[model samples]
Target: MATTFPQHPSTRLLRDLTHSLPMALLRTREAVVQRFRTVLSRHGLTEQQWRILRALDGRDGLEVSLLAEQCRILLPSMTGILKRMESRGLVRRDANQADGRSTLVRLTEASQTLLEQIKPEVVEVYKEIERILGKRKLEQLYALLEELEAGLLEGQS
Candidate 1:
């Protein structure tokens, strides 16, 4: 008689040996984004809009391509975001002086003021999450995520 083995690992073995890190990460990201979305909702801002605002907020003025790179968004999506932000008076876009073909993006005074007002609330959200996760775990999580991002981005490059 011949002995046969199962094609897949046993459920107990899978549960014990394999960590659902990816799924856990996805859920955590979704939860955090949802919380941030709630904050943005008060100001009628979408997630993409917030991302663009933060990118422009960090660097007063940037080219569309640079904004796209910072936000990790596609060019077309960034174009639409700019249009919406422009309409809402949150951002201004002009032809780059050095290169007319390139568009420059900047946060308008209104957008800057809005960002300043919301900065505390944003920080509060992060603080709350850190408190929940505890400082040590949060730091560890940040380190691990940074490593993962660096690896993935390096591979892309």
Candidate 2:
């Protein structure tokens, strides 16, 4: 026979894991990403690949580490992503002239052309989001998100 501790409200550790900020954000992201997945799939691109390509679209050449940072992708993971994209003729990497140890990545002509072709579809998707949220609310949402990010970053220091 074993004795068990009595449960009490004071002893409760968390309200609910489902209500966690990270999980909530992830759920919202998944919802938004689902809406874009079809368009990406039709273009024969993975979400990560698309992000990398979009990050490099207008830029001439960005350092691999900087590109990964801007795209919020891990460096090791980006290496594989770039390899696949390079094989597809969507991107190319060149050694940084200033630093032989560092590499820079840039979009290829094919990807640039593809981006131009897909602009309308992507814009349509953005319009649909605006339609759903309304312009004012969308603007508010962006402001609120930026505020939250700034607040959190500020708190870190």
lDDT of each model, Cα atoms only?
Answer: 0.88, 0.90
Best by lDDT: 2
Q: Give one digit per residue, the lDDT tens place, for model 1 in 83-124.
A: 988999999998899999998999999999999988898999
List the candidate 2 regions with Cα displacement exceeding 4 Å: 1-19
After superposition, the stretches of candidate 1 with alpha carbons farther than 4 Å from their true spots are: 1-19, 155-157
Worst 10 residues of 1 by lDDT: 9-18
TM-score of 1: 0.83
- What is the lDDT, from 0 to 100, of the residue 82 in candidate 1? 88
Question: How many clashes in candidate 2?
Answer: 0
